[model samples]
Target chain A: TQLLEQSPQFLSIQEGENLTVYCNSSSVFSSLQWYRQEPGEGPVLLVTVVTGGEVKKLKRLTFQFGDARKDSSLHITAAQPGDTGLYLCAGAGGSEKLVFGKGMKLTVNP
Target chain B: EPEVTQTPSHQVTQMGQEVILRCVPISNHLYFYWYRQILGQKVEFLVSFYNNEISEKSEIFDDQFSVERPDGSNFTLKIRSTKLEDSAMYFCASSVRGGRGTGELFFGEGSRLTVL
Candidate 1:
């Protein structure tokens, strides 16, 4: 079974603080995707990293795929209240179906 | 910009009742999928549909669950009998291509299902 485990399942920080969340797995994947889901909303794709050791950024968010393709991480710089949401990492293997992580709920307090 | 849309934002039904969730994926997209997220849990893949047939499905999608693209625009997921475990936020998504290329899937806001 392919399972993606996320660390720091919940985080609360004041605005402007930086934080990092991680997703790790025992299975290597062909591609990894990061998504941010606001309360009551579906997940929105933040970035997709395909190549091992690949890195991608979107505004204040940076996503990194491990060299082994078995892990990934997301770093947020100077988080704001607007950045509060559930961050999800999903890994795609040989098929289109994605294996999603449990997600980290981040609360950026003002 | 186009987006996927779903109906019945929230539904509450008694256990053993049948329910059908609907979705209209982005036009021109070839692949469709259904996923669910239990409260405070990770999003789980339920099934994937393409070419008017189910391309893939998870163990969670058992005999009681079925998917159909009855028309060019609409996709539906039907649960023959609902259980408490089936209650979750069901999300519909689509991708222009399979996961290998971009691996980007566009998701709808989701329909909340509650079993009483």
Candidate 2:
């Protein structure tokens, strides 16, 4: 079983719609990072949330770290076609390694 | 912006053959790492290197797998003998500092290995 569990493994929405993706884990992490990956490429860093209950925003995207530091969520507003990709959530544990969730594939239709 | 670069974007080899995947991490970065993603799976951490030595490694990184910083600019992963299961996309990432804090990793496009 994956240390991190992501809900709604797949999501499809129309352009301009809003959606939220969740990442949950039983283990506490020092920090959590969200990345978006396109086909035939590597994952790109979206944001890193370190403080519990902290919220950060990037343009139309919003990210929040859980109060317990064991979960996170990513919300995209007015989603566009350019927003379509595989969203991955990874947590950095006590070690240097980053444990990644299975990932949520989001497809925004035009 | 400086980014990690990997070589031999795609490779095809037979089982039992050896393969070497190369990566040039972002300049000025202090940490280097290797991760692999099998099709339709999550990215799995293979190993992390710091100060010229392996700082951490996952169970998937076995005896057959080895990493070397042959020179100052390049980090390479060598698979002594490959198996069909070794086919996957391997990514090389680097960070400015070490630890689980604010250091965000920069990754390359990844090298796809196909073991037949």
Candidate 3:
């Protein structure tokens, strides 16, 4: 079975600090997506990276797909209290069904 | 922006009881899915529906679980008999092009099911 392993299961940082979360998998993926979920709500899509070595930016967040397509990363610049949430990385393989990572819980204290 | 919606934000039921969770995916979406997340656990895929049928389902979707798209917009998941392990937040999601292209899945707020 395909699996995505996320790093830094829990992170706590002061507002304005920078942080990075990583997702790795032993299998290749056609595309990878990043989502941020708040309490009592579903995960909100942040970005989807398709091509290997591709990078996309959304305001303070930057997402990168590894050259091998087996890993991905999310970097937050100057995190704010609003950025605190559970971050999840999911990978799409041969089928449309997604394989999700364990997720990273981020806490940005103001 | 269009979004997926689920009814009964929370449902409490006893073990061995039947429960049906309803969802209305985005009107134009062609693919629908059901997922569950146990408390403090990662989200897991339960089933995927397309073209009025289930295209895929996870191992977790056993004999007791069933999915149906009775109409154009509504998709439902029914559990014949609930168990304490079934307690979790069930999410409904939809995508226009199955993520093969640029379209991403839109998920509902989710229905929290507490099986006693």
Candidate 4:
């Protein structure tokens, strides 16, 4: 099975709508990271959560690490068309290498 | 802000040809990694390097694939024999330290390899 799994392979919502995406894993991780990617570009680091239940806010987005360090969620408050992209969640497992999930493609309409 | 840079931006080659994708990671970063994404596939980790040696590698990084830090600055991934399956976008990333604790990987715009 894929070490990391992201929910809602694709999401589309109107501007100013709130939405949430998820990343899940059966195994524990030292940390989990969230990234955004555009076509032909690499994933850009958005946020990283190390502590269980940790929450961080970036502008209009909120990220939360799971209580068991096995999952994470990203919530956008009033998402904009500019927020549209591929959202990926990566888990840092043993050996300090990261395992990535099939990202969710998010589109925010006008 | 400083960023990772890779080149050539895109490369097209025939099967069995050798191809080297080079990356200059964030200068201050100590850990480097290579990841790839086939069209429509998830980003997959290929390998990680630290202290001039491979720290870890995924199953996809096999005998035909290798990485090197030939100079203090340039880190590269070379495919000894490029197969059609190797066609994908390869990304190079680096972090301040091992795993960066929180895995803050700074990635470069990927190098697209098209094997014909």
What tens digits encode model 2's per-residue C-alpha lDDT throughout B1-116? 89999998999999999999999999899999999999999899999999999999989999999999999999999999999999999999999865455747888999999999
Query: What lDDT score is found at residue A80 in candidate 4?
Result: 97
Candidate 4 structure lDDT: 0.93
Number of the candidate with higher lDDT, 1 or 3: 1
The residue-level lDDT of candidate 4 at B87 comes to 98
Candidate 4 C-alpha lDDT tens digits along A79-109: 9999999999998875657889999999999
Task: Give lDDT tens digits, candidate 2, residues A1-105.
Answer: 339999889999999999999999988888899999998899999999999999999999999999999999999999999999999999887677888999999
| lDDT of candidate 3 over B1-116, digit per residue (tens) | 88899988999999999999999999988999999999988899998888888888899999999998887778999999999999999999999888455537789999999999
Give the DockQ-based CAPRI class for model 4: medium
Which pairs of residues clash in candidate 2, taking residues 3 or more apart in a chain or in different chains?
none
Candidate 3, residues A33-60, lDDT tens digits: the string is 9999998999999999999999999999
- Candidate 3: residue B74 Cα off by (Å): 0.9
Give the best candidate by DockQ: 1
TM-score of chain A of each: 0.97, 0.97, 0.98, 0.96
Candidate 1 runs further than 4 Å off: none
Which fraction of the native contacts appears in each prediction?
A: 0.83, 0.72, 0.55, 0.73
Rank all candidate structures by their DockQ, best first, as comma-separated numbers: 1, 2, 4, 3
